[model samples]
Target: MRRVLDLAWLALLVFMAATWQFMPDLVGAPQQAMPRDQHMAVMLAVAVFGVWLTTRGALLVARLAPGLVNLPCRDHWLAPERREQTLADLGDRLAVLGLGLVLLFAGLHYRALQAAQPSWPQVPDIAWTAGGVALGLIFALWLLALMRRFGRLAPVTTPRPVRRSSRSRDLVWREVQPVWPLLVVLLPIGVGVGLGLFFRKADDHEAWLLTALPLLLTAALGRMVTEVHGDRLTWRFGWLPWPRWQVDLDEIVTAEPARSRWIEGWGIHVTSDGRLYNASGTQAVRLTLRDGRRLRLGTGEPRELLQLLKSRIAGD
Candidate 1:
């Protein structure tokens, strides 16, 4: 499929070049007489330019400075060991996008070129509008694949919880695993609402893409868990390990319930107080490191977690 796309892209480029040079000739008759819409012509040109700029520009950035490429789990991908492999992988994915756009625009241009000698046909405005929707869907799928692939930052031999012995166990707490019932019920409704809100006469079906957010959020954080194994305090959302956090309990100077304004929103974010790692609610346990930097961990049992943290920091 990929190779076929590459061949099609090459052929389309040749065809477009031919049309560009000999637009006055070699064109056939139109199916119907419609006035040439200047506005539509300009919009199509702009759309083509935009695609070239984005896809080709990304390819340029990858070649010159690979570090600038924003990647999920960037620390691992940009590391000296995996840098080349990461760049090559990303470049290929981007090429796929460029190919798709070329194929897409070429088809629209060809359809417009038909039935109009010396000038392009008066194609319906809806043709390019539909093309734009397809373009958006392609971009969304590209992003999903990129995130899912680079998001796994865990090492091959990464350790997990084993049989707990008296000396090994300190604390183990599971806050909440996202409920399938809740999502299964709420997602379709959310999507329906989103489509209702953002739907446009111009065929803007982009709102449906918003549904991917909740799905990704749930996949990323299926469960919220925190544990203290000896001196290290660790926490992670669900089974994904890249976004894990670890704190040195001995270095903690204070532990308390966190305070947050409504503006902070959710997820991992930096705030005036510190960094917040929240999955759902605003409730969290705040810890202040000796260096004055603070961090908050969202928790359901804040009182017990706070007490345990205080005792650990106090050398109990």
Candidate 2:
């Protein structure tokens, strides 16, 4: 289902490119004496450029480090040393992902400047280029907040609650288990490339091709830096330095699986009163609060993990 949504997003970008290409009059009447053919050519060129940008983005996401993708999930994998390593690995991935998002917006801003057209209506250019950068930043911050909520930044030395039971104890959930949904970035690129090839309205395929490249590349790089571990109910997308979040059991309200057609593209949802942890599908355990409100439990669900949490919380 997630893949399907990605494909849909890709189609939207391709359609945008195609529409921009075939219909020049739609954008605006040619200001200069540039021939209609030249105007069409330029529009086509931009469409291609858009495709490239979209593709580049996807490629960046896919190329994240291998260790993030290959973290062990079995019980033995949870040895103290391994746990420490997981924490370290996750922190690095988050930092990297955060930095990557910042860079992405910066690059978008730069491109917007290069794309500025004084003679043409400034609104559309600003809307596309500058507005895009703004939106990207907003999205990045939103993602960062998610990391924070997951308790990614808490100091390791912070005093922790005492677990009286020796048989079972609360597992501190830190880094996001590396998951591969980052591949979704490719959806837009695929659509751009596919449309460019199939939609023969334009004489030049270069237009669509150009637009797909950059988006795919960027997506790949971003993917490479992170992975969501459905088993661990965590995501690892940082770089070499950064604290990984470790969501404590007390803060979690309810952890239940959820689905969404839009927001998450399809995964789990962890909500706390339909607010704070209100993230959409990504495979979450809904943490039910004392007020009956819910929060998110990251990606993984061990055998009877929810039962264990409930029993533990009840005792508390």
Please tell me which predicted candidate would have the highest lDDT against the true structure: 1
Question: Against the hidden reference, what TM-scores do the models get?
Answer: 0.40, 0.33
lDDT of 2 by residue, 126-189 (tens): 5567766766776566465444443322223323345445433334433234334434545556
Best by TM-score: 1
Q: What lDDT score is found at residue 93 in candidate 1?
A: 69
Task: After the best TM-score superposition of candidate 2, give how far the Cα of residue 49 lies from its true spot, in angstroms.
Answer: 33
* Cα shift from native, residue 192, model 1 (Å): 8.5
TM-score of decoy 1: 0.40
lDDT of 2: 0.41
Q: Tens-digit lDDT track for model 1 on 1-316? A: 2343456566765676565533433333455433445424443565556555656677577557767878788777767776676766666667667777776677666565654443323445697688788888877867776776688773443233332233344555445535344356556666666667565522233354455555655666656667866566887775655456677666677788886655876565556565687656667888876544578887767887887777755566
